[model samples]
Target: MSETTRSDVIVIGAGMAGASVADALSRDCTVVLLERESHPGYHTTGRSAALFAPVYGPAPIRALTRASAAFMANPPEGFADSPILTPRGALFIAREDQLADLTGLHNELQSEGNFKELDDSGIRKMHPLIREGYAAAGLYDENCQDIDVAALHQGFLRRARARGCSLFTRADVIALEELANGWRVRTPVGTFEAPCVINAAGAWADELGQKAGAEPIGLVPKRRTAMQIAAPAGAKIGGWPIAVDVAEEFYVKPVAQQLLLSPANENPDVPCDVQPDEMDIAICVDRVERAFDLRVGRIETRWAGLRSFVADKCPVAGFSAAVPGFFWLAGQGGYGIQTAPALAELAAALVLGKPMPPEMVIEGVELSSLAPERLSA
Candidate 1:
């Protein structure tokens, strides 16, 4: 191992979270960013549906989404030529048989706030794609938007580069050891030392922590498959809103001239380059066909990605108490794309002894909830 490699901070994994952390920390310190892949965002970040809805998940995730809006509203200068968010409504459709589910979802929405109620006639007027038999009731959220994920990812990397941070792609960490003064990381290229190591390995976060001699946080990576299908002949789908069945069995949104669809399948999977299975695709087809009256066509392209979830389905971002100088920034589930900016800022604050935003430090989101010690209990 070459001895001349060191930085003030070392971040493993160059996906959205890792890239954001590296970029945020580089402003104050020399940062070394490492990625196992040849390029950043090749995994879950690239494979995301890129929605920026704040009222779609659990309380903690909703809080993160709310905290992230400021960044997404006005991203760093020159982050993208166009605005990050685009207006696209979201509708949660429910069938007559799903009355109970609709009631439960309505209660949850009431708890979350800002969702417009839609009766059967109102839902039919808004979305004609629903079959005649379906659409007992629905809820619409106008705040739901399409996130420019690629631009956001590039924005972070550009900022990192502008801050003189060194990003090392194709350099995977093979081993990590704690030194008296800092941490030593052995990568494919050489050995590096840093006062702290940020574990932003996404789905492989727990495994990476175990390799670094830190306790695992019980992170579970699940596979979610999405496919693009040919647009119906002469059908105007581009202007249609994003729609999902009440059961969440499937969701489809217009993407340019095609359609982006997902079965919302969450099967436990080992961390790797994921591929969609025929069964999953078939399930997606069944769900879509069941809800909509349109004739389904062939799938033009398909892929699967890992959405890593912590035990509580919330992001864990803080330093490890069991192993000092090691930080945890994983388990973002599908919210990583939407909440990257706030979570990264929080991580930077916790790591660099800066002040954290009060809104982001609320119930089950403070330093205590994020500490690695919670995994033991």
Candidate 2:
């Protein structure tokens, strides 16, 4: 026996992307949000090292981040009791051999963020933990900040529900049947039909697309691990900015009175519940200790998450050219949280057949860059 339901749109994941798009579209249409897990954001969204770094991704991603800046900085009233962004600057440090890379990055990001180049002494002054002679130069971006990811995800979910959107957790999508005018999605709980079906299943997006008979976009899910260690004695870590190697060999940041570190590994992986590897943790500790004066105490906790990317390493958004009413909102890579607002708005506008939002246009987001047709072409 099976139950049946219908809506104007069916979102096939309840993570940040799904929640944001559902919230946006629910304003004028019926929305059904489906999650495989018992709770929303049980995957990447929950495990994100959430940061709003405008200069983190490629040009298209930076444009989206710029477009989302206003929303993150000042969310709508009643969205959350506290602000979504908090002051937590970022420092990209480089050794002598990586000076050119650091300079290039700083030059490229000057237009997108407030980045200042610093010499070894300046870098040491900003973050004294770096061992002497390890970092020859650094780039500081004060505009980077910590993001309250839970608040943002909950805000989207709450807004969507308040607007009459239905959310179904533990609704594993087993099949997708394309109808003449809509889609029939069979899940464990019931069958949901909608004219528009959005694929926002994060790392499993390519699998969902194949299930829907859409062409694979060659999305690769990569594993990233992070572990927390006790803060060093007599050192106040709360005020220290996030420190990342210019080549992304490793990164460390303060979290909940502990130091969170990652080797910045991106091992190709299949979509599933990810776990941290002991070798990766050892690599992180080795890299951090070699670069900084801090010794690693016992790893208090550790975890891993997947960050999905396409060949071009840019997000895929917009309607599919082959499959009518099938939308592509995947391949966010590691920039999903920072660029959610703009991408959600863009997805909604495209779905509604409306013009690009003026703000997004001003932010210099070229629709062609994000269109799914680009993959086929």
In terms of TM-score, the best-performing candidate is 2
Root mean square deviation (Cα) for candidate 1: 1.7
- What's the CA error at residue 28 for candidate 1, in Å? 1.1
Give the lDDT of residue 303 in candidate 2.
96
Worst 10 residues of 2 by lDDT: 106-115
Query: In terms of lDDT, which candidate is strongest?
Result: 2
- Tens digit per residue, CA lDDT, model 1, 1-377: 26657899999999999999899999899999999889999999999999998877777677778888878988867877779888788888888888788789778777565678788778767777777757888888788899999989989998998998888888888999988987988888878899899999999999999988887888889999999987778878766778888788899898888889999999999889989988999999988888887677777899999999878787888888778899999999989988888788889988998888686865234655556667677
lDDT of 1: 0.86
Per-candidate TM vs. native? 0.96, 0.98
lDDT of 2 by residue, 213-257 (tens): 998888999999999999888888888999999999999999878
Q: Could you tell me the lDDT of residue 327 within candidate 2?
A: 96
- The superposed Cα distance between candidate 1 and the true structure at residue 118, in angstroms, equals 2.0
True-vs-predicted CA distance for residue 224, candidate 1, Å: 0.4
- Residue runs of model 2 more than 4 Å from their true location after superposition: none
Candidate 1 residue 369 Cα shift, in angstroms, is: 3.4
